[model samples]
Target: MRVLIIGAGGFVGRHLLPNLRDEGMEIIPTGRSPDRLRRLFPGCPVQQCDLSRDRAADWLPRLAGIDAVINLAGLIRDGAGGFDDVHEQGAKALFDACLAAGVRRVIQVSALGADEMGTSAYHRSKKAADDHLASLDPEGGRMDWAVLRPSLVIGRGGASTEMLAALAAAPLPLRLGPGDWRVQPLHVDDLVVIIIRLLHRREPFAGRLDLVGPEPMTTDTLTLTLRRWLGLPPARFLPLPRPLLALGAALGDRFGFGPASRDSLAMLAAGNVGDDSAVRAFLGRPARPLAQALARHPAMAADRWRARLLPLATPIRLLLAAIWIWTGIVSLGLYPVEGSYALLAPLGLTGLSATLALYGGALLDLGLGLALLLRWRPVAIGAAQLALMAVYTALISLYLPDLWLHPFGAISKNLAVAGATLAMMAMEAEHG
Candidate 1:
């Protein structure tokens, strides 16, 4: 079957085309940007025509041989005319063109809650188009349409990831007061499978359908999941007051960021949830778990690792270096381990400092070394080691009264962080 996917250069579209092509079906992909369309699907036919900007009259004739048209094109902006231009107007134009081209089987990629009241303009526009598609039928009355309504389509690419990475990379001290918002993220691969199935079914169309992942998680959990994938410190989400957020939204709008703040908060507030039983039954396979999905994503993981580990290298190196120096002095001047304890103990300075520098710092160094040489979990290992050392320092400072210089150890410890961290990275790179 020939499948014509509009907006075939977007996140979901980019993920979908390869699957369809692998199935050995010819695909005609359309997008707004000619370069993007060509870059995404070089072998498959690509047409550059913005559904909102260009009239369908010029492209409908070219869509002559299209059997099924999947519209993935949509706009995501708040206020004024962005939604109307892309979501509604663009979709309507594409549908009209598909109809003229005699493309009967249309699969509309709609969003959850689009048909519900109080939905955003983006949601409302999708709902309106969905309603229009459901109303159309041939004289014989074969419904000839199916809708794949996905909530929070999560993929390793595109705007959502860029946004998440940007937020994760911020340098300011973050403090969030109890993040409890629940959300679900669907894997683009799973959603694409459902879409492929929907495109071929000849049976009478049912009402709007929904596709979702198998798990639900809190916003805090989501942030942590992203952190683990990136090997970065967990995101510290501070709860901005609603009024402050509103002011931010206003500022963002003024600065031409659209209404990202308002819309994002609205989404976070409502929470994205849906029933997945319907599609799961059809797929005969459970949706990919968010954790598993992230683990399998190396590109996102690499990008995030670069963001997290690279900047902290200098400080970490300095700390590692300080730890070594302090340990070296304590072991050489004060604490002696190998020789007789009678001689070493009477020295009064105690070999504990020297022992810590040689042994404790070595353990720290080797642990850090292994962390860099291997690609297991560097941030996690670093955090654990830091905690342990901090506790050790606190205990010694309290009991011994003379060795309050432990904090200074961390100053030199960070020097080895880079080499060890890189070893781990190299291992991961080679295996991956």
Candidate 2:
């Protein structure tokens, strides 16, 4: 059967595509970036279509000869489009196009909290699309649709999984607020199995299914489990008050960093527990527990390295930025200009040349520092930082060799900073 998978470039979609292809299904994947999709799933027919930007008319052509549709499109945080556009309008348009094109089945992979009781905009917007799809009826009345509301899906390549694992691997793990917030974490692989079952089943199963794990777990328990999975020893967590977490969420909202936004905080407080009977019956077995699922695939060396190094990536970047920026500020008149020029004069720099070298080097330092801070072309910035450090160290060693033996180890510290920069670059490349 031919299937059209929307948002096929997302984490869940990436997993689902290969599984379906191995099951002998003709897959037509659609995402915002066709080039990326091609790179991700070679030899498969991929289409470039943005649900938020593309309308029903734009989607009609892609729906031709499609036997089934699975919409895994969602956003944790708004970008390029708000929640309403992506979750509501875009989804509605896709459903409409499906009906118009005579597609028989659609499975919407929505979130667990997306219901009438949902408080966050993320949930409410999802509910809107779910309602719209439920309300639609085609001329033949043969349309079969199921809304699968999955809890926190945990598996490799999942953003939430990576984030939680990194947090667990931190030297000092933090217990946010009371640490009582709970979730029924489902394995992404299990979710995929259910979708495949739904697609192949002869009997029509129409309605919503809350796909969740066998048991609910507290956030603390979840993190601890992840930590143990990484083969790390148990750690004492540093407790953080609700106010501090709230402040961090506020900062995350303002700066667009991390996953501590207000909406997520509210959702966490509400919790993500749900009945798993539907999932169990649908799959003909209980879903795998988080610990068991993780244990089945032992954490490889790369996994352990990722868990350990990810948390340190930001701090390393910040430290390097501060070093470069502070040095520039000190050189640009915060310290005596005469001293800077005196340091430069040993290399035959004098008069206007000395002044130019002093100020010009200071400006370059400031620019590199700001680039690191802003995360602009990190690989390039890292290379530049390394090269500049090498040049400075070589010049100092040749002209002012005594400074290397100074009590402060001022010249010696550059080696350590250069090493840090290389580490940061490796992390960036790993992420990309």
Candidate 3:
């Protein structure tokens, strides 16, 4: 059977594509990035489509000759209010298009806790889409529509899984408040298998079903389990006040680092457990246990190290940026100008020339700090920083060699800083 899979470039899509390909079904994968989709599903028909922004009529032509449409398109959290567009209006458009195209089946991958009175925007939007799709054509029986509302899904490359894994990799013990909230974790592999079975069955399955694991786990237990899976020692954790966490999230949202907003906190507060009988009935067996799933995909040291170190980049960049910005501020007004001139005078910089050099260097430092913090041309910024440090060190060594032996180790410290800058540049180049 030919199928159209929207949002086929996401984490779920990454797993689903390979599995679907193995099933020998003709697949049409569509998403925002045509290049990425092409790479992921080479030799298969791939279409560039954005459900949140594009017109439904535009996607209709592509839907032609497609037997089924599986919408895995969704956003966990969005700062730009794109969730409503993608979840509600986007699903509406796709449903209309599917009906018009006479598509035989449509499967919507929604989340657990999706209801009319959902607490979070993410859940509310998902519920709105589910309701809209469920309201169509029960009497006529024209389309086979199925909605799978799975609880927390765990798999390699999943955003939520990665986040948890990274947290588990932390150097010190990590605490996420009381962590009493419970969730029935579902394996992505299990979910995919169920979908495949449903697709192959002669009888169509209609209505919403919860796809969850056989056992429920509390947040704290889950966290500790993941930590043990990563081969880490027993770590202590302290409960954090919900209000304090919310305050931090609000601040993080403003800075773009914090994707975990109040909505997510709300969702966490409400628990994410569901009945798994439907999933078991479809799978013909009980769902995979959390321990078994974790054991099956044993954690690698390299992955753990990468996860642990990756988060350090932000703080390191900020620290380095702050150093430069502070240096600029001091050079501009805080530090006596006479001392700056005295230091530069040895190198023949005097009068207007010395003033220009001092102020100009300060401005350059300020600009570099801002650029680094903003992540504008990160590779170039890293390269520039290395070059500047090297030049400064050379000039200092040549002009005032005695400073190298000073107690503060001002000139010597540049060696380490330059190395860090070089490492940053190297990392950026390799990753890019």
Q: Compare the candidates by lDDT and give the number of the best one.
A: 2
Model 2, span 62-170: residue lDDT tens: 9999999999998777644578898999999999999899998998989998998998888999999998888885222578899999999998878778878887888
Query: RMSD (Cα, Å) of candidate 2?
Result: 2.3
163: Cα error in model 3, Å: 2.3
lDDT of each: 0.64, 0.87, 0.81
Model 3 residue runs over 4 Å out of place are 39-44, 345-348, 377-379, 398-400, 418-432
Candidate 1 backbone overlaps, count: 29
The residue pairs in collision within model 3 are none
TM-score of each: 0.65, 0.93, 0.90
Q: Which runs in model 1 stand beyond 4 Å of their true positions?
A: 54-56, 138-143, 169-178, 202-206, 233-241, 258-261, 299-301, 305-432
Compose the digit string of candidate 3's lDDT tens values, residues 1-432: 998899998878888878888999999899888887898789888998887876679878988998888999987566687788898888888987888889888899998889765777888888988888878765327888888899888887776776666667786645566777888899888988988876776776578888899988888877777788788887777565787878856865666552356666677778888788998899888898987877888889866775576556667777778888888888998999999999999889999999999999999988998888886776898778878888887888899888899999988888887767766665456334
Worst 10 residues of 2 by lDDT: 134-143
Writing each residue's lDDT as its tens digit, candidate 1 over 95-164 gives 7776777886788888877876636666788887887677665331543677777877776665555444
If ranked by lDDT, best first, what sequence of candidates would result?
A: 2, 3, 1
Candidate 1's error at 150, in angstroms? 1.0
